[model samples]
Target: MKKIHNYFAIVFLFFALHAVGQTKDNKWTFGMDIAWVSYSEADKIAVGGKFINQTPRFSLAKYMFKNVVFVGSVSTAIGDNQTYTTFDGAARYDFGTSQNKVVPYALIGGSFINARILTPTLNFGAGSTLWFSPKYGLNVQLLYKFSEERFSSQRSHIMPSIGLVYSFGARDMNPRIWSSTR
Candidate 1:
């Protein structure tokens, strides 16, 4: 836990320093997330304790509108007897003014999980991003996920994650506009 916290602090500071200006174009945002996951088993299978599972996630996002982004992420669980992976596609809606340093967002998505059984999952969550500059920030999220099998009850999990995001594109482009115009 200490190591993880240190890693997060380093990433935050590195990005904060480099985040200096605003960009005007629609950019692609790439990020890496580290999460502590707690699993609630539906069957008798012992998944493991919370905080024991480390999930490293990678995500790519594009701005679809002034306040909306299309995001896709892939994640896997480590330190478990069973192999688990997930692929998700989600829409994130940013709330509050674009000039705010901290922007909150709500996410809703569908996910496909590959584990002992292949299951489709529903994800609902909310998070916030603190932008040091227009193109660089820190993102933190809490997500609740639900999956059900044909003959079994629904299984659920809580995932809390933090990460760094870097956006790439033209530096002078307006983020709120669909076209490249100042």
Candidate 2:
């Protein structure tokens, strides 16, 4: 677990530094998600029962390039007797022009899940956003996650979520970073 955390920290730092060096017109987005999560193998042992669950998630994203965004997310699932948490970092690629009101995207990422045992996870998914206005939007996503623990040979999770996103900074156009030459 310690090693996994360290790896994520290093990766996050690298992306942050890279983002800072690249574009001055980058935008930031903060979002809240509601998801239905179903787990395999591990959930039985961890929760001591079989149950379907719901999770509330939060995420932050930075648009580092025209179509590339770096994202960090956290979610927690609570049941009668147990709780599970996940932390994830991912890169997303938007499929169409940003000017469009609706845009689809795909993402791949690494995740850390804290359950009965700490498990490192991998996820891949696709999602779309419907921007009602320049600063606010609705997002929907579906993700498949894979993980393994000593006690549980192989564990998988399916997560489908819907959320609202709030954007900060200029919309669609690059903001001027310096005055034009006279």
TM-score (C-alpha, index-matched) for candidate 1: 0.71
Model 1 C-alpha lDDT per residue in residues 1-182, reported as the tens digit of each score? 56855775677557545531112254467777887667755333444344334456777887776777788988776656656677888888875333455667899998877765667888999988766666676889998877654524225677788987776643332455332333
In terms of lDDT, model 1 sits at 0.66
After TM-score superposition, the amount by which residue 98's alpha carbon in candidate 2 deviates from its true location, in angstroms, is 2.1
Clashes of each: 5, 0
lDDT of 2 by residue, 64-155 (tens): 77788899998776443555678889988885345556667899998887766677888999998777766667899998887655537336
Clashes of 2: 0
Candidate 2 clash pair list = none
Tell me model 2's lDDT, rounded to 2 decimals: 0.68
